[model samples]
Target: MPQWWKEEIVYQIYPKSFQDSNHDGIGDIQGIIQKLDYLKDLGVTMLWICPIYCSPMDDNGYDIADYYQIHPDFGSMEDVDELIVKAKERDIKIIMDLVINHTSDEHAWFQEALKNPDSPYRQYYIFKEGQDNQPPTNWRSVFSGSVWEKVPHEDNMYYFHSFSKKQPDLNWENPQMREDIYRMINWWLDKGIAGFRVDAINFIKKDQSWQNGPVDGADGLSSCFEFTRNQPGIEVFFKELREKTFDIHHCMTVAEAVGVPYDQLSIFIGQDGCFSMMFDFNYSHIDITEHEEWFPLQNWTMQEYKEKLFLSQKEIFKTGWCGTFLENHDMQRSLNRLIRNPQERTPKAAKALGQMFMFLKGTPFIYQGEEIGTINNHRLSIHDFDDLNSHAQYRRALQEGYSEEEALDFVNRRSRDNTRSPMSWNSQLYAGFSDVQPWLTNNEYYQDINVAKQVNDPDSVLSYYKQMIALRQNPLYHQTLVYGDFISLESEEYVIAYMRQDDQQTILCIQNLQNKETHFPLSSKAQVLLSNDQVNIQNQQLKLSPYQATILLIE
Candidate 1:
């Protein structure tokens, strides 16, 4: 593992909502510059900003129109250069979101591809002749509907899109296209940024045969992932990617690689692996379903959640590292997902959840508002939604006989919009995010949960995050926390206990996930290193308050 990357605590920023410096109702590079001290003080060493490239806003900037330029809404390339320099001054690193799986339809390459079938750029994207009047395949896009979009003025010709129609999938089978992507990545690295959080990189390789996949949905369309996800030969692309870019610069790379074979974990993150680490989604995906439908989601029992977390940790620790996170721009807030009971989702519980993951055997990532314990926005309507995936799911629910209210409830619970809401910096105008209206509404609870209210409070969730980060980066416990072996402890329902052991020390971390106080047996000698609540210790026993968590240094 790269020692620097392993020691990092990455903070993800959804650029459009993080902070609006120009008051244009959108966050920008300048906005990020304005908040560097805040992040530095929060104890994060790396910043992973989601796509801020030139785009048509399809998929919220994931659909890139220009790789070399920053989106105007995000400020000029000069602002980005300034951000890198400024961040360096504070000893922080910036990791860009590398999104080469697809490009916006408005991109010049795609536009040229549309004008003529024989254009040189045509080979840059996946375009094929349709069978009769139907699409070339039965695959469904991730955003919804058919994966293929017909070319205008062309007979039975279509282009494939794994996501939105406005975003056309790139043809990784084309060697020139791969070279182009590599060159673009190296160009960015030359600009002095740390590296990239590769987006949907696992989707780059496609099944050589483009045959239709088995139907798995009511729409008669097969999931594109069924045929293309983590397909064979994909590793070849990554190996080359690393050689041409990351390996040369010795930069950090965390891949968003879904459906990777468990046995092949070493190939993805080992010392000579393609990436420094890869995100493990098993824990965050507990509420999801295989059918891609939201309504039939399952709530994780404490055991189920713990099992998933343990498995991922154990597997990754064998050969390489993992990127541990409870929430990102794509998922609903962690507090709402982990603590289902509304009343149980308090700041104290949030702190416990944060502590549980930060000390695990991996790099911990804190999303923009995660440090402040942001919860899902429960009040939302179909009309107020902007996320294409959420809007598609809402329409699907209505067509499948769900009541309008029920469908809206599902959207409220599952929408990425829940995390896209502008950061609540202060209680004032636009939660101190902007002077004008934000692109999306600020969370209603922001008035009480804003950063200004918690930044100075000793007991705030923000403060607890600082404490946890400091502990993880603390010189005294650094080695044990980062390289220790994780051992799970047998405990009752609604309780999670684990130990991190290195050559000379054992750190026991315990948490009560429920609202009721629980009695825990103390089977060893220990001293408190950290705790979310006041604890009572009797003769070889521990009495833990509701949602309490503690890190104990076992003697």
Candidate 2:
């Protein structure tokens, strides 16, 4: 049951912001190749690069125009081949972002389908006849507005798009289309890439009955999630997808399954499951009331967050595995989200947060700038943002009668663009990400938090990440740390504690989730393995510092 991916530590690269070679102000394959040694030194065993396929840049590469060709902005096929070979040389495997749930409206198939109603490509996407001059169903797109877009010159015809209008949902019900997707996946696997981080995979299957769901928002359209996400009979498509592609090559697949419930974990990740693992957003989105709207933030306590995480861990333990992470391209930085006080978001706080998740009983994923403890960029204007979803949310807030300033503040606090800012490599011009201005603005604090500042500093967040990764990969505790059973530990209100245990040993991880000192009982036989701050222990009682993270081995 042991798998190589299970033991490997993954580092996710948002290529467009990672690095730029040739002074083009755009990050490309060559830019990534230049960072291989840096990743190797950081103790990363695998790299998950976001989509770099040919596209019109509608959804920042998620909307694929050509699955077979690399986007010119990223590089050519030869460059990608070089990247794979180079990464492999450094003991790092690369997994691409597989976005088969939808394709760019500019894709050849969509174009062909748009040009002729009778084209075979027409079946590749979902098209329906309008109902009384309205969309077939009142389903709201994930990005906002109606999920249907009227087709020009085609009488009463509309196409369904789950995310963006430029991104058309592929008809998974189409047998030929499914086979074509399988072939494309096999082609990538054959090219020597490891596998994929499947994007929007849960939305692939939809309700066969096109009926309007109960409207959940003032917009009168129901959240498409009710009818499209993790729908019934989705297992058939999942089974076929696995058997046809992933199983044949034995490639690692992690699905972005948003709406899957705990009771259904078995169908997605165990021996008979569809993927190797899946991301659980229950704890990650604790601050938000819903994934669709950004306003009216939900208040969450450390105890509540701990319970949500423990529940996910317990459920996933029964059926399959999970990918533990704090920040990614889609959300605000971990430091910003976890620490409420802007001044308290320091290197120590970042290390504390990183330590909380790194040693869990699952493969840990480090986002591109997370190792350096990057915080969210604070841009004042909405025009300074690039995420389409941010614009939609701003509009939604206005429609709900919020002031422009209030709406902008909500977007500032929750925008995906907060994490999409260019990665800070050095303190030089543009943070050494590019010779010219980056496509997105650099973080204002990049000068103080760039990788160059902490690469050699042993006390830095970057160094702490390297230490955690080394400990996980160390043969001394690899079996216990990588495959151990996760057990929630009883702790105080502001503390998140857990134990990773096996027959050989038990490792206890305790983190103070707030900026206040607390106390926890420690066993006399426990040996300190790691701590983000100085430890003060006396008479079986340990005094924890503000935002402290401690790992101990029980002998």
Which parts of model 2 have CA positions greater than 4 angstroms off? none
lDDT of candidate 1 over 176-248, digit per residue (tens): 9889888999999999999999998888888878898887766788888877677778778878888998988
Q: Give the alpha carbon lDDT tens digit for every residue of 131-204 in model 2.
A: 99899999989888999999999899999999999999999999999999999999999999999999999899
> Which has the greatest TM-score?
2
Which parts of model 1 are misplaced by more than 4 Å?
A: none
Q: Cα miss at 372, model 2 (Å)? A: 1.0
Which pairs of residues collide in candidate 2? none
lDDT of each: 0.89, 0.91
What TM-score do all the candidates reach, one by one?
0.98, 0.99
How does candidate 1 score on lDDT?
0.89
Residue 2 lDDT (model 1): 39
